[model samples]
Target: MRTTTIPVAAAAAILALTLAGCSGGGDDTTGGAGARTPAPPTSAPVTSAAPTPSASSTGGRASAHTEAELTGVFQRIQFRPAEFTTTDAMLDSVYPGLTVSDASCLAPFGVGWDTSDDAGTVVFGTSNDRSMTAVVASTGETAAATDLVEDARSALTRCADGSALFSMQGKPIETTVETAEPSLTGTDEAIGWRVRGTVGGNAFTLVGHTARVGGDVVALVGWDPTSNTTNVPLATQMFVDAL
Candidate 1:
């Protein structure tokens, strides 16, 4: 097999979506139910339709923190200024099939920073072997947002022993999943998980967290080739408090 280096940011992106139940492959034994037969490896990318407009879109007000304010919040949490912010359009182009079924999980729904809307994302660290990403967004659905966090908790539990089999950059890879306690406190809801596996002979570990704050949702993803543990809750709390 040809050697390939999956950048930390790229792995973070893939892991975040996978934890959201976006990536396809492997038996779905989630919910403590009977295992669903594993689907055949697919060459097609996973795709989802845009979220249905909620009443807030028409009647209630949907608010998001200004980019500058969000930037300030990230800075307080130890993230450097965003080297490059991504918009919804950019995300669509880069991740065509990536989608979050629950719009309440606004952080994963829009992926990276959404320049067109009130949401934005930032990447920190300069090392190619490690990277961290923070995403924050508001959907004006406090209850739904809270519920989304709970749903994520369930998904994480179900997928704890599952494996993700998919292609990255046209190369096939498999990652084992494990559940981790979400350390976030004083929040509406939160959960986390860890993924470990090898890519082109290079072993990697990814830690991811998703949390809901009032009417907003935030997700933090950290990737390291050498270490398996990451301080995801700290970064999550910083974004949640800022919201």
Candidate 2:
């Protein structure tokens, strides 16, 4: 894993959504029979939402992207004049090989990197192995904190590594991904699941909590990784509850 320095001004970026946040697998390359594609491990077939569209599908907007989406932007979202903050040790704990060159940035997301620096209102940080990098804002950061919580709920709706997941509201829309009948099920059916992933070659887990946040439907978008594939119930609550 190689490490490198990322500039502050160049590192800051404002994603479409309003808040902050932060998966994994082995290198087994065995294929299934004559096919080169490795057969997915037969983990017990965990049933959650069957993958169906929620009530929000009726021309409704999402409150925000789920945790998975926000986490997906860990390396993609950066804030100018870095404002929010996190410690180096915290980051290292989450991402083993993280290194910070700025020393003036902070990771507003619940997770952090090995090295972090703050520059004015802007924050900067990089993974130890340099596989990921990100920056966030501390200005008006508290206001976005609520948005962050909502994102977390959305994350659960999409994928919870440990606990079972189901929608808490509307029925999950069914969609075909490969040969699997993965349905998006109702929000009432989408809940639970552990959050797990890797950063800088280290394993990390995030679980618990379905925080409520204030933000419009437009405020939350493109925040979770599972958005494209599944709907997040918690996120829907935040969006609908947003004032």
Candidate 3:
């Protein structure tokens, strides 16, 4: 992993730095083929935009899903399903699946999961950085977190020839949708968007959702939070599976 680290404190209006799905709401870990046991909120805080809007939903899905719900789903996976986690070795092993290349990876902040239930955003992030915000969506879209992954795929379709979507401060990141083979799932004609963003004041590469994973879309995103971009993309991609 590179040693580039972006300070979250310098980011503008960071909504919530807490890991996704570990809210104080009680353990919401759900098991397979059985009723889910609601555990106490795992010390993680839910990041919400200020001036909270009167909950209005766009899609039929309930307003934003709680982090606990997202986490429960991750915990239910056959292996360590977390997109990002406190366990470094576990993160290193699982995150590679989400990557466009081994050279890129998810940055670290606090290893936890997150959900934008109100905005229909479900994310499991490694760190908190302004440039790290990956998805933007309507609350209705979030209800179908899987669909949001499809939406991301659709958006990528717009950028042919390996174009990527980027988020920049005081500017809009340009993107051109493109098609690529998912190196992990061995799916041809898989949908993808190549993403680029500024890190440590320089252009950096980020990629996500190159293939469909068990009816879900996954993306890997990264920045210069650490000089190494090894696992950031894998972490973001893990969020898609966790959703």
Task: Estimate, for each residue in 19-114, the C-alpha lDDT of model 3 and write its tens digit.
Answer: 233222222132221123333434233221122122222334334445465444334221122433333332332232222221111221111213
- The pairs that clash in candidate 1 are 46-97, 113-121
RMSD of each: 15.3, 20.4, 16.5
Q: What TM-score, computed on C-alpha atoms, does each candidate reach?
A: 0.52, 0.20, 0.34
Candidate 1 per-residue lDDT, tens place, 19-86, comes to 33322233321222222333332322212112222223123343544557655554444443344334
Clashes of each: 2, 69, 52
User: In model 1, which runs have C-alpha deviations exceeding 4 angstroms?
Assistant: 1-64, 80-82, 85-130, 147-165, 225-228
Better of 1 and 2 by TM-score: 1
Per-candidate local distance difference test: 0.45, 0.26, 0.32
Cα miss at 226, model 1 (Å)?
Answer: 4.8
**Whose lDDT is greatest here?**
1
